[model samples]
Target: MRPSVCLLASAMSSAKGMSPGPMALLPPIHLYRRLLRAHRKHLPPEMRLLGDEYVKAEFRAHRNVENPVHMIGFLTEWQLYAQKIEGDAWVGERLDPGKVEKMSDEQLAQLYELMKAIQKRGTEEGQDGS
Candidate 1:
């Protein structure tokens, strides 16, 4: 739900006959947000944060500032944006995971940082065959 993503959603909502179904929604990225708004009330626990009818469906608010998911979306998109801005330095875009894996150790470390930034893994360490 980055500002750009919100704005994208807003645009979709404003257009006439923009049904909240898979077919009507051309871009899957935009469709993702609309579907959330269309079914906000019934969204599962994991998706409720992205479901805001008023903010996204009503006037199509330019991003839901209150939604925590938006922050994650912003950071994820920002990661790509940063790499894009440093285009020359970024040897491989996020689009090329295979190339990314073969990147230098420094690039690998940077990618790891991006992966860990929003990670929410529960510490479940357990003893194996010791």
Candidate 2:
């Protein structure tokens, strides 16, 4: 419906004898979000930590920028943070990448399981609350 309306509008304008160049469909913000969703799967293994919610938050934070390209810097930061599974929290608390790497494979696997369980519980609680 929307597309038909747009086409009708454009056709009317053309009937008035004006040139119809290409029209920009989605705005910068919408395009930004679509690009993020499209490429999330392409992110490296560790960097996938910053999931949908995290990306949405970052998108909100970058909303002030007129050009969406400015969001590249914010996205880079998010990627780096996500990749640091063993890094310090935003402040100075020690995050030992070496320590995480040195852990036994079983320990690492268990930790991954724990993270999944915690995420699932959190999601359930949020749904229940609402």
Candidate 3:
């Protein structure tokens, strides 16, 4: 079994709660490490660079979060992303419309910036491709 899957199973099997799931099972650090490992194993160099930095920044930003709802949402999204990366299913995928609709203004702005950055990188690579 994959490390993340094992972690999830361990978390669930040990749970005594009413609704134990991914968010309630895996700890933040374990998920963070799993993501980093996935990126290292699956991503190209350029993507790994960007993904690693983004993951570090995000984890650092959320280090002190006290709200369970927010923390659950944050961890759940990252966990899904890790699974996607591990499964080699992330390339060329479009953002989900439902997820976009649920985003706050700040999150939307961040997504816009990420889009612009990706476009800029593609343009630069195209120009250099000769």
- Worst lDDT 10-window in candidate 3: 1-10
Better of 1 and 3 by TM-score: 3
Cα shift from native, residue 111, model 3 (Å): 0.5
Give every collision pair in model 3.
none
**Highest TM-score scorer:** 3
Q: Could you tell me how far off, in angstroms, the CA of residue 101 lies in candidate 1 after the best superposition?
A: 4.2
Question: Is 2 or 3 the stronger prediction by lDDT?
Answer: 3
As a TM-score, model 3 comes out at 0.82
lDDT of 3: 0.79
C-alpha local distance difference test of each model: 0.43, 0.50, 0.79
In candidate 1, how many Å is residue 50 off?
Answer: 18
Order of quality (lDDT): 3, 2, 1
Off by over 4 Å in 3: 1-13, 17-24
Query: Candidate 2 — which pairs collide?
Result: none
In the range 64-119, model 1's lDDT, one tens digit per residue, is 45454444343344334333433434334346676666688975775576455324
